[model samples]
Every structure is written in C-alpha cells, then in structure tokens.
Target: MRVSVVINPKAGSVNPGLIEEKIRSALFRCDLVFSKAKTLEEMDQFLCEELAHKTDFFLICGGDGTVNTCLQYLVRAEEDLTKIPPIAVVRSGTANDLAHEIGISRRIDQAVRNILEGSVRNIDIIQISSGDKKAFMLTNGGLGIPAMTADLANQVRFSLQKVANCPQTAGFFKSIAKNSYQLIKKIGPGVYSLMVAEALRTWDPNGWELEFELPGDKKFATNAPIVLVNNQPSIGNKFLPAPFTSNTDGTVNLLLAEGRRVREHLSSFLHLRNGTVSQSDRFTSYEITEFKVRSKNPSRPITFFGDGEILFKDVAELSVKCLHKGLPVVVGSPAWEK
Candidate 1:
C-alpha cells in the first residue's frame, strides 16, 4: 500500500530524526512519500498531490490543530469523497485529542503499526457556516468558555513557538513546555477554569445573549456563560463533555452551561471533568442532527471556535450540522471507547 505521511515539523516536541527512523523501520515494504508542512500553503500543496494520486493511507503526524488544518483542506477540495484517502493520526501534538479518542498510540512505531492493522471507519464531521463562509470540524467547537480557553492556549503556544526559533531561548523554552505539556494535558479542565477567570476580567463577562434552534421548530434563548457543541465525546483530551457521543452517530451534542461567577465556573468545570455536568441544573445537554445559533444582540458579535481554533471571528450567527460519515478515518479501535 502507498502511504502519504505528512508531518508538521513544529508540532509539539516531535523529534524529526526519530520519527523518520520509526516510519522507515515500520513501513519498510510500503511505498512511502513524506512531506513536511510548516505553513498552510505547503499543507494545501501536499494534500492536493496526495488526493490526486489517491494514496491509500494519509497519515497525519501532528497535534489536534494540525489535524484540523488538514481537514479544512480536505473538505474544501473540489474532488469527491472517493478522492480523499482514509486518514490516520499520530500523537505528535500536545493535545492529541482525536488521536486519543481513537486509541492512536503516542509511540511512533506503535502508531505506524496501528495504521497497518487498523480498520477504516467513516466518521461524522461538523459543518459550520457563517453567511458565505464555511468550515469543518471533526471534534468539537464552542463560543463562551471553550473559545476563551482555546484562544489563550493558542496565544501561549504561538509565543513559545516564536521564541523557540531563537537559538538562545530554544532549549530552555522547549524543556519547560515539554515537561509541562503532559501534566497540563491531564489537568486541562481545571487549568481551563483558571484561564476562563483571567479571560472574564478582560473579555465580556456578561456572556452572550443567544438563541438556539433545533429541529422540529424547537427554540430556546439563553444567556449562558458557555456553549459547547461536540461531534466527539471529549474536549482537549481531558474533559468528557459528551461521554455518550459517537462521532459516527450522525448527530452532534450541545452543552449549555451557566457559570457567571468564578466559583461557579470552577464547580461547573469540575463536573465537566467528572462527566456529570449534564446531571447538574447548571447545564443542559442535547443531541441533535442540526442547529442554528444566533446572537440576540447583532451589535455584539460573538466569535466561534472549532477544534481548538477560531472558525469565525466577530460573527453574530452560525449554522452547524452533522455530515454523517462525512470522512473516513483509520482507527486503532472503536472511536467511542476512549
């Protein structure tokens, strides 16, 4: 089988020499083509060639953001679904959420073996639209608390990455980040609450006034402090916000939370990590095939984030729906188990 391996050279703390060694050792008999995508334009170019040639397996060696960026290109391609190859993700990012969900191994050799032995599973992708703009997400997205924490994390990541380019600070910064990366990945929800508290001091603490419309003409309005929509069960590889969700189930889960106070936010986040947020009166959960979210105040536009990145900035409305089995992914085991 021909495997097109795309690696994000700057993703997490991946050792390029070690990764190539493992790939060569594990995939000795396969026709392999490797590409390093350091920019979006480079990623697009490699993806175009891979799709045109119809590589059997497109292995993504990166973190969640890298995987999401690849999906953005795949979804926007002009070719049909058949032209797109089944994807395999390796745990090369700090928060390899999707890889963790699908039981992809963090070890390069094991992940390569999983790709060899894994089965192809068609999974749902969330299609998000705001006016004429459109984006696709495989895991989760949100406004309020989710977006705030993600924005903060991205900023920190960007700053550290920028400094890592400097020869003087590279070793020190990388060492700190590498040591703390796994620790923070495990205790993400608590860290997220702290980040949210900091954000509240600078952002609009009152939260957004928005309306949600589901199928059957059901409508509700909320001034909730957080609104998370998830195609998969987990967020950030730590919190199980939708424990029962299956990415292949042809529906997305919605979670609305009310936590205006810092203490309340902390409490809600604790429940979120424990997978009991929906049981509390402070939160409401729904499983729907599609929905529409609009800000009650057009003057105050709310930004939407998907898969840990900004999807639409300063947008008053969003339309989101599940495209059932929209993409084929190679999973080590059933995706919902983790």
Candidate 2:
C-alpha cells in the first residue's frame, strides 16, 4: 500500500523522532512519502506535489488546525470529494477535540495501529461563508465568547514567543498554563463560574445581534453575548457544551447566551456539563440544519471562529450549513464498534 504521512513537528507534546521511529517500524513494507512543512505556504506547496501522487491513504500527525489546513488544501485540489483519500489522525495536539471524538488514540504507536486497521466513516462538515470567503469546519464553530477567548489565547502565545525568544519554550509554558487551568476547571465547576464573573467585568453583552432560521422556517432573533454552533459534543478538551451533539445527525447544535449580566451568564454556563443550560430562560439552544447570522450593526462586523481558529474578523454577515456526509475519515474501531 502507498501512504502519505503529513507530520507537524510542533504539534502539542509531539516527539518527532519517536513518532518517525514508530511509523517506520509499523509500516515497514508499505511505500511511504513523508511531508513536513513549517509554514502554511510551505505546507500548501508540499501538499500540492504529494497529493498528485496516487496514494491509498493520508496519515495526518498533528492537531485540529493542521488537519483543517490539510483538509482545506485537499478540498481545493480534488474536484470530486469521493476521489479524496481517507484520512486518519494521530492526536498530536493540545486539545485533540476531533481526534478524541473519533476515538483516535493519543499514544503514537496505537494511533498508527488504528490507522492500519480502522474503517472509513462518513462525517459531516460545516460550510461557512462570509462575503467571498468560504471554509469548512469539522468540529465546532462559533462567535462571541469563543472568538474572544481564541483571540486572547493567540495574543498570549505571541507575547510569550516574543518575550521568551524560543518557540518551544513558549509552547511548553503555554501548555503548562492551559493544563493547570483545565485541572482547576475539572476539579470544580466554580472555577469556570469565577472566570465567567471575571470576564463579565469587560465583556459587552450587546456585542452582536443574531437572527437564525430553523429547519421548519421557525425564525428567532436575539442580542446575545456568545453564540456557539457545535457539530461535536466537546469543546476546549473536557467541556461538553452540547452533550447530545452528534456529527452524523444531519443537524448542528446551537448554544446562544442571551444573558445581559454576569450572574445570569455564569448561571447559564455552569449548566453546560449537565446539558441543562438549554432549559435556562436566558439561554436558547437549537438543532438546525442551517443558519444565518449578521451583526446587529452592519457597520461593525463581528469576529467568528471555528475549531479553535479565527475564521473571520470584522465580518458583517455569514451563513453556515451542515454538509451531510461530506468528509471520509478513518476512525478507530472503538468509535464505530459502539
């Protein structure tokens, strides 16, 4: 069999030497082509050349961002979706949200083994559009709090890199900080409540006005501080914002917070894990096939993000639709066996 392996050396706690050794040992008989690039531009070039070769599968060793980037290029290169090779992922990222959802192992050897034994599953993809820009999302997409937090996280990472003068050291410190935060949040839900309280000190509740239409032409409008559209159940690692969300359900789960005060918002957020936030008077949740969102004030565009990456900035309007069975992925048996 012929395989194309795309590895992101900087993803999470990845040890390239160990990963490469495992790959070489496991697929010793298969014809393999390995590609690694530091920048997106370089990755594009490498993908263009490597994808043109007739290959059986793509083994992607990286985080969700790297997987998303590769998928973007693949979509652009292949005119026919069926012609694209099935993709298997190794969880080499901080969150690995999608990877975890698909039951991919974080261990390097086990992940590779699963790739060799996994079955192809058709998963939904979200098509997002704003003006002339369009992209696909595999996990989750949102505006408001998610976008805000992603921006803040990026800024923090950049500042750390600039001050530390070493990207690896910066990433190490960032991982430690994030792990600590996650540990605290896991230990007690009150940690998130405290965070929400602190965030409300500067958070503007009237940041965006949203109007959405459900499957049956049921329309609703709201001025919300945060809006999250989830295709997968988990966000940020362990937080289950939409516990019942299913990627193959042919619908997207929407979590909209209409709270205007810190206490109200905090109360709503605290119910995320229990999936009772939707029942709150201050929050609205919907299962819709498609939706359209525009800033209340068109002059002031809202920032939007998906899968922990910024997708649009200063965007006046955008639409999102669930693309049913859009992606062919190789998932571990644990995911499908159930």
**Candidate 2 TM-score to native:** 0.86
The C-alpha stretches of model 1 lying farther than 4 A from their native spots are 164-194, 200-203, 333-338
Best by TM-score: 1
- For 63-117, candidate 2 gives per-residue lDDT tens digits of 7777888888887688777878888888776446788888887667777776677
Model 2: ten consecutive residues of lowest lDDT = 185-194
Residues 1-338 of candidate 1 have per-residue lDDT tens digits of 99999888877666866887899898999999999877899889998998888788888898777889999999889446655789988777756778877788767887887777778888898999999999988888898767887788767656655554556766777677655554554453345545665666655655468898999999998888778999888876567889999999999999988766777777777787788876789989999999999988877677888877788888888999998888888888543233
* CA RMSD of all predictions: 3.3, 4.4
Off by over 4 Å in 2: 166-199, 215-217, 335-338
Best by lDDT: 1
Give the TM-score (vs. native) of candidate 1. 0.89
